[model samples]
Target: MFNIAYRMLGSVAEAEDVVQDAFLRWHGADQSKIATPPAWLTKVVTNLCLTRLSSARARREQYVGPWLPEPVPTADGALGPLETVEQRELVSLGVLVVLERLTPPERAVFVLREAFGHQHREIAEILDIDEAHSRQLHSRARRHVADARKRFPADRARHEEIVRRFLDATLRGDVKGLEQFLADDVVSWADGGGKVTAARRPIVGKAKVLRYMLGFQRRPELKEISAEIAEINGQPAWVLSWNHMTAVFVAEMEGERVAALRAILNPDKLRAVTNWRPV
Candidate 1:
């Protein structure tokens, strides 16, 4: 249930609130009146998310800079065991950002169909719409995400190796080494949520990204921070802590090159990862 809410809302704090609210409503309801517990709970949580989405969309619109989904560590199986490439891809920061462009109904339909594996008919029942409408919503959501999606590498060993090399090269400001793993069109986005110093806009292109990496490595502040690797959102990411603030860096891969790099430096978003020990 928390997993469903997390995927729908993209904020751990909000999802926890939704789950608590659902429980309160469930406890007050007439038990005998509820026909199926699972369906009843799902409907309650999903609708709660839909209501939140109306406002969430507005918040993102006014967000200071490039907004990103809160990266949750998958080591605890909190987001469930994402064992398949498709499942991991769906939870990734890049894909979640794309899903943000979707309408509330479209997102709900997509999450139900792809993440939870619900049939069109079941999805319709959950959303309180006809089966045909469910299919339409799912189709639209898929089309919205299809163009931006990048499938996760099928082999875990190779994926880790690439990230390791990239991290090593990046820490040392090795441009040639960085180019080996990054694509020419690679883009980087940092989200500080207006609370800290960060790039106000996306930094695009391999050259610009490498410059940014090199510049960051030369920062006097880097000396105070400790860096370690963690599996976040089902992929390898760097967790850096300095001045009591946590930030994460992850590369969204496309075969041998990195399609994107996400730096989640938002103080609020870093809360979940701050205490997480690497797996």
Candidate 2:
């Protein structure tokens, strides 16, 4: 239930709330009326997420900065079973960003069919739409995601090695060394939610990203920060803590290099992650 809601809304708090609402509804309903508990619960949860997405989109439109998805510690499979690279990518920071472009129904159809492997008939029943409409929605959603999705290495070991080296270079302030690991057109986005200082727009190009990262590292307030590499969304990410702020830096990899970087600095988004232990 959480995995479905998380993928649909891209907010852990919202997902949990939606799931709780579903539980309350289930408790009130007569147990004998539900022909299939899993299907009934899924339908309730999916509809709840669809309703939340409508309000969530409006909230994001008025959001202070780039509205990145809430980063969660997935090493414990808290978000669900990510047994395949495709499954993991569906919940990745970049893909979740792409999903924000989709409409509520489109996002629901896509997540249900792609992430959960539900047939069009099942998706249609869940969303209360026709099978033909479900197929159409899935097609459009798939194209939107496929076109924007970054290619990541399937080998977790290699991905971890790259992140370690990248973190080491970052801590040492080795700009030139770090440049070797970045793609030429790499872009970086920071979501501060107006609670802290962050880039209002994405930093584009390798040189620009390098400069921004170096400047961020030199911030006086962040000088005493603690940093570690941890698994987030099935990939190794840099988790930094300083003062009362916790930030997660996740890289979108293309082979051995990073094509993009997503930094989640919003206190609201990082609240659940502050005490998360690395796997």
Candidate 3:
């Protein structure tokens, strides 16, 4: 349920709240009257998420800067199985951000069909819609995310190696080394949620991104904050903390180069994964 809600809502706090609400509802309901427990609970959670998404979309309209998905720790498989590249991609921050382009129904259908391998008929049941509509929603959602999706390393060891090397290069201000790892049109987004300072807009282009990286590395405040690599959102990411600032850098890969770098600096978003020990 947490996995479904997290993927649906792109929020750890909200997903947890939705699960708790579902539990409360389940506890209050008469089990004897329920036909199927799993299906019943899934429907409840999915509907609850739809309600939240409606309001969340409104709030995000007024959000400061680019609103990125909350990064979650997946090293322990807490959310669900992430054994396949497709599974991990579905839960990635970049893909989640792209999913925001979809309507609530479309997002729900996509997550159910793609992440959970639910047939359109089952998805229709969960969302209280017909099979035809479910198929249409899934098709639309796939089109929206098709261009946004990027390939990433399936091997944890190789992924970690790239992340660590990227971190090392960035910290040392090795522009040449870092440039080699970035895609031609690479972009970076930072989500501080207005609580801390961050780039209000996405930094795009390889050269521009390199300049930003070099400039950010020169900050005196970051000197005391050592970077730690951890498995976040089913991939290795850089977790940096010093005083009140906490940020997670998730690299979206296209083959061997990073296609995008998501910097989640919002204090609220980091709570779930902040305590994660380095992998």
- lDDT for each candidate structure: 0.87, 0.88, 0.89
List the lowest-lDDT window of 10 residues for candidate 1: 270-279
- lDDT, ranked from best to worst: 3, 2, 1
Which parts of model 1 are misplaced by more than 4 Å? none
Total clashes, candidate 2?
0
lDDT of 3 by residue, 47-145 (tens): 999999999999998999889999998889977888888888788787898899899999999999999888998999988889999999999999989
Q: What is the lDDT of candidate 1?
A: 0.87
Give the runs in model 3 whose Cα sits over 4 Å from its true position: 277-279
Q: Candidate 2: list runs displaced more than 4 Å.
A: 277-279
Per-residue alpha-carbon lDDT of candidate 1 for residues 197-279, written as tens digits (9 for 90 to 100): 88989999988988888899888878887887778988888888887778899888888998889999887887678757531
C-alpha positional error of residue 257 in candidate 2 after TM-score superposition, expressed in Å: 1.7
Best by lDDT: 3
Task: Report the CA-based lDDT of candidate 3 relative to the real structure.
Answer: 0.89
Q: Is candidate 2 or candidate 3 better by TM-score?
A: 2
Question: Which tens-of-lDDT digit does each residue in 90-188 have in candidate 2?
Answer: 888888999999999999999998888999999999988899999999999989998555476789789888989998888778988789999999999
Candidate 1 residue 107 Cα shift, in angstroms, is 0.5
Which window of 10 residues has the lowest lDDT sum in candidate 2? 270-279
